[model samples]
Target chain A: MNIIVCIKQVPNTTQVRINPETNTLIREGVESVINPFDTYAIEEGVRIKDKTGGKVTVVTMGPPQAEDALREAISLGCDEAILVSDRKFAGSDTWATSYTLSQTIRKIKDYDIIICGKQASDGDTAQVGPGISAHLDIPQVTYVRKIEEISAGHAKVERLTEEGYEIIESKLPLVITVVKEINEPRMPSLKGKMRAKNAQVLKWNADDIECNVNDIGLNGSPTRVIKIFTPPPRKGGEILKGDTHEVVAKAADLLKNVIIG
Target chain B: MVDYLLTEEQKMIKELCHKIALEKIKPVAAEYDEKEEFPWPIVKILADSDVCGVYIPEQYGGMGAGIMGMAIATEELSWGCGGIALAFAATGLGTFPILLFGNDEQKKKYLPVIASGKKLAAFALTEAEAGSDAGSIKTTAKKDGDYYILNGTKQWITNGGEADIYSVVAITDKTKGARGATAFIVEKGTKGLEFGKKEKKLGIRASATREVIFTDCRVHKDNILSREGMGFIVAMKTFDSSRPGVAAQAVGIAQRALDEATAYAHQRKQFGQAISSFQGIQFMLADMATQVESARALVYSAARMIDAGSKDIAKVSAMCKLLASDTAMKVTTDAVQIFGGYGYMREYPVEKLMRDAKITQIYEGTNQIQRSVIAMNLIKELAKNK
Candidate 1:
């Protein structure tokens, strides 16, 4: 089995600071980490390769520095890494990003399964995974909580839903967006870290992947951010000090007024 | 934490162990300490991360970073929980004899298994009668045709029943006094080998301590370390290498106490102001910080000296163990003082740290024994110079 995992490099959310004046993220001095959710994707991809006796190839599309994230994925047992980077890819939205990745996968041209996190923490759009499936015209399973079974050319998985879960059976050549419930990620071993340190990540750009010039960068993106701002802080509610019955009636009356208004 | 000018590999070991400490060990430290349960889960985590072989050579399937790497890993894990970290550190203590004295076949046979972290190893020299006076151990290893029958009880043995391999020193020929002793590799499941009930400890309760009993337990003559009548030398050499590890554990425990006290002092209010603002608290914090840093410096230097293949390291190694363990005791006490009433309560972390700090001074040979070793080295060096 040829397994490919898509990952993203995002600012470590805990250290992120927003500039109140510019209404933009303050990126300077912030550490970059592999997206928290994408770790699950990397782990799932590695697990599949472990069971099927194949190689796990981790791919990411970002600036040159994003190689660190790919290297980290390698340290976590990914067999190979590919970096999709280009100046023209700047400001690409979910559609363009997915398109570029799909083109990169096509260039590889030998994948039985593609794995991705349900969403990137920074964007929270949860679109790129499904978008890649759509671009490739392959069956996709999103929010996969468990891979119940996998064989020669088929897989059974549990798809998490609002109610509970659904068992979905899909043939080979499928894209899966995994949830945290899928598996617990392993820490990198010294041997793996040494491998990551010396491993060379294959770098490609817009031209290398043969992406359509019109559908490869900022111009290709369909969505645009008009403005970014922090939401207004919620105000504290008034305390209802009285007997239980009285407080309950007062709370009901206030809630009714707000709902009616 | 001041940068000790560690190499890149050492830094990686520090970072990875720190991550394990924060993400895995810290959360469960309290429960394990309370329940007195061995930290098998944490041990498994350490094994999965390949932390078990930080000091072992690459030929034995280790990272080959040496003693400094081991120190860095120990300090970080102990920062999370000293007791939990002992499961790893004590294994190092047990494996050192093999690393330092075992022949080629023994190293090939044992080090790889230990390096893989599939099994834990323990040192069993301590007995009911042999605390500081290690020369008097009565566990007899009587020679048979091809095997030695071991008969004795080892007390206060860390990782006793749980460890798969034991490096034990016993009297091979009682008539020769200290020279009569011999060190042997004894597997856990050998017939006549049994373990007594676990002892309740004031601290490091997450670690297992029990009596290792051998009743007519037979060990192959090939298992003898560096031939017979060299048990004392083997035991001493193992201590020389492993003492730094114990010191690192002390430094880790001390550093944790300082961190907890500092964080608490900033938020704790007194006289309508943060307690940390007062000169009294400031002085205490300053002293604690200074002591912890100094202890860490001594430990790193001693560990580096050993790794650098310095021949005369017994004195410095003993000094590091003595100073760091003493520092841990003082700093932890001060940390509890900073926490005041809350420090005395079990609900707070400092009290447990205080409890944990006590054993570092007591174990791996008492502070008194360390001072004696240092003094003996000092006198011998002076005599040689004269």
Candidate 2:
């Protein structure tokens, strides 16, 4: 069984600061880390590889510096890594990013499963994984909390929901967006670090993956932000100042008005 | 212009170890200290993560990132707990004699397991009779046709009975003085070899320290490191290489104290404002920060010199160990002062940091010993100029 895991490098949210003048992130001194969510996806992929005796290839789409994320995945026991980076891929949104990832996966040509995090921490849109699945035209299970079993051409997994979870079965060549509850990521091993240090990350450009210019980068992205602003701080709720019986009646009236209105 | 840069691999190693220090080691540190137990759970985490193999060679199934890697990783681990960090670093202390002096057969036989981090290793040179004077050790290794019988008691051996492999220094011919000492590899399960009572310590209490008793414990002649009567050279060489790691540990301890003090001062108020607003408090923080950075620089430079294969490493190594450990002692004490009454309580971390800092000065040869080593080298170099 060959598994391919997708990961992204994002600014550590806690350290990131917004530049009020430019309305953009001030990344100068901020540290970059593998997206926290992606770690679980990578861990799950590696675990599957470990159990079934196969290879796990980790792929990512970002700037050249994003190679760090790939190397980090390799340090967690991924067999190989591919970095999709190019100047033309800049400012791509979820649609373009997912299409580019799919194109890279298509170039590899042999994979039984593609795994990804439910969302990137920087932009919690939660659209990229499902977008990639749509591009590949494969069955996908999002918010996967557990993988029950995987064999020749099928896999059983638990998809988390607001209510609870739903067990789903999917055929080979499927996509999965994993939740944090799926698995705990392992620390980088000593030997793995040596290998990652020497390992060559295959760098691919948009043209290298045979992608069209019209469907890549800023030109290809359909969504545009008009403006960005911090939401107004919430005001404290009104407190009922009266006896308990009177306060209860007033609170009930307020709740009834809200529901009825 | 001065610039500090890390190789891509080193950066990854630093980040990884830093995370482990924060997430794994820090939480359990106080518990282990309180219980005075060997942090076997932490040892398992370090070994399983293959952290202990960072200094070992690649041919022996390790990262082979060398002394710099070890120092970087050591500093991070020490930030969590000095005693536990020593337990991990002592493996390198034990493995270094073989790495530096062992022949191909000895290296091949002893290194792979250590590299795999499957078993812990120990260095046993200090005894009741010989701490700084390794030459006066009473442990004797007698050659007896294909085997040597080791007999004596080694005190305060780190990793002690828990370690699987031991690099022991014993006197082969007492008449030759320190030169008569020979290094030998003694497996833990050897007959007549036993561990005496474990010593209770003031700090780094999480790590086990005990007496290794060797009474007619026969070791194979093939297990000899380098050659006969070269144990002193092996011991000295190992210390030269390992001191930077101890220095890094000191730097880490100092950094942790500074971190705690700075964070505490910002929130802790006296009069009508945070203590951080006071010039006195600010000055203490600035000094603590400076010391930590300076200690780190010296430790890193010494480690780099070792990796670069510098021949005159004795002075620099001694300087780093002395400066960093002394800095640790001062910074931790001041951190406690900054905490004032709160720092004195065991519930707070600064007190533990202060306690931990003291051992760095005492072990891996005391700061006094380090000072002498530096002065002796300085005098020798001055005479050479004439």
Candidate 3:
């Protein structure tokens, strides 16, 4: 099995602050960390490789500094790392980002499984993983909480749902977006850190992956962010003041009105 | 938080240990303390992360960062919980004799297993009759053919019942006094080796303390550490190397106390103002911070000197242990003072820190013994000058 894990480098959400005047994120002086969710994706990929004896290649799309995230993944037991970076790749939205990653994976060619986090902390859209699956025209199972069994050409997994879960089986060369229930990530060992320090991260540009010029970067993106602002604080709900019988009748009437409306 | 100019590897060790302390150890520290249980789960986590090998040689499946690495690791882990950190630090104390004196075959046989964290090791030097007067230990190892039969009991031994390997000191020749003593390796399951019930303690309650007993327990001659009649030298040398680790634990406890006190003072209100606004509280915080920082400096300096293989380390090592332990005791008490009535309650954290701080001053040789060692070194230096 050749596993591929896609990750993102995002500002640590705990330390992020919004610039009220500009209505934009104040990225200055903020520490960058792997998108919190991506940790589970990397862990699952490593797990799969460890069980079946395969290689885990972690890939990320960002500036050169994103190489640090790849190294971190390596320190966490990812076998190989690739940094997909290019100046032209700037300002890409979920669609373009997923398209670029799919092309990069296509170039790698021998992957049996591709795993991604359900969503990135910076962008809670939860679209990139499915977008990659669509571009590659492969089956995808999102919100996967566990891998029940996996073999040479098939995998059985549990997909988390609002009420419960659904068991889903998919053939080889499929995509999966994992949830936190998948596994608890392990800490990096000293030996792993030493290997990460010296490991050479393969860097690929848009042209290196043979991406279409018109379908890569800001111009290629379909969605746009017109403005960014913090939502206003929620107002308190109205409380009924009366005897228990009267209050119950009034609450029933209000709930009935809401349902009817 | 002053910059000590750490190497990249050292910084990595510090960062990883801090993460483990915060994320894994701190949350369960209180529960373990309450249950008085050995932290085997946390120890397993440390082993999985290869932290058990931080001080061992790389050839023996360790990181080989030496005493400096061990000190850094001990401080960070102790910050999470002093008692929980003992499982690792006590193992370091036991392994020091083997690392310092074990022949090639012994190191090959034991260090790897210890470095792998498959087994914990312990040092046994104290006995019912030998507390500060270590030369008077009653445990005797009589030679019979190719084996030495050990008899008597060792008291208040850390990691006694739990550790898989033990470095025990016993009297081989009564007439030779200190020189009559010898050190030997004793496996936990050896015939006639037994452990007494665990002793209750005022602090570091999570750490196990028990009496290690021997009754005609035979250890092969090959298990002897160095030559015969070198037990006291081995014990003293081992202390010289391990005292910095104890000091690091003290610095960690003091630092945690200072942190808790400072954070509390900023939020605690009295007279319609934060207690931090009062000069009295500010001065106390200042003194605590200063003491913690100085203690940390001394520990790191002493640890670095030992790592650099300095021959004249006994004086500095004793000084660091003395200063750091005393600082931990005083600072923790002041932290409780800052917490006021809340600090006295079991519900609060400062009390536990105070309790934990008391043990550092008494263990790895008491603060009094540490002072004596420093004075003796000074006197010897004076004699050399004369």
Q: Candidate 2 on B1-386: residue-level lDDT in tens?
A: 12459887677678778888898889989998899898887777777678878888878877788999999999999999998888789989999999999888888888888877678889999999888877789999999999999999999999998899999999999899878999999998999899998889989988889999999999999999999999999999999999999999999999999999999999999999999999999999999899889989999999999999999999999999999999999999999999999999999999999999999999989988999999999899999998
RMSD of 1: 2.0
What TM-score should be assigned to candidate 1?
Answer: 0.96
Would you estimate the TM-scores of all the predictions? Answer: 0.96, 0.87, 0.97
lDDT of 3 by residue, A74-166 (tens): 999999999999999999999999999999999999998999999999889999999999999999999999999988989999999999999
Each candidate: RMSD to true structure? 2.0, 3.8, 1.6
Which stretches of candidate 1 lie above 4 Å from their native place? A18-24, A235-261
- The candidates, ranked best first by TM-score, are 3, 1, 2
Which lDDT value does model 2 have at A42? Answer: 95
lDDT (0 to 1) per candidate: 0.94, 0.91, 0.94
Error of 2 at B160 (Å): 1.4
What is the C-alpha lDDT profile of model 1 across A27-129, one tens digit per residue?
9999999999999999988888889889999999999999999999998999999999999999899999999999999999999899999999899999999
- lDDT (Cα, 0-100) at B178 in candidate 2: 70
Q: How far off is residue A79 in model 1, in Å?
A: 1.1
Q: Sort all candidates by DockQ, best to worst.
A: 3, 1, 2
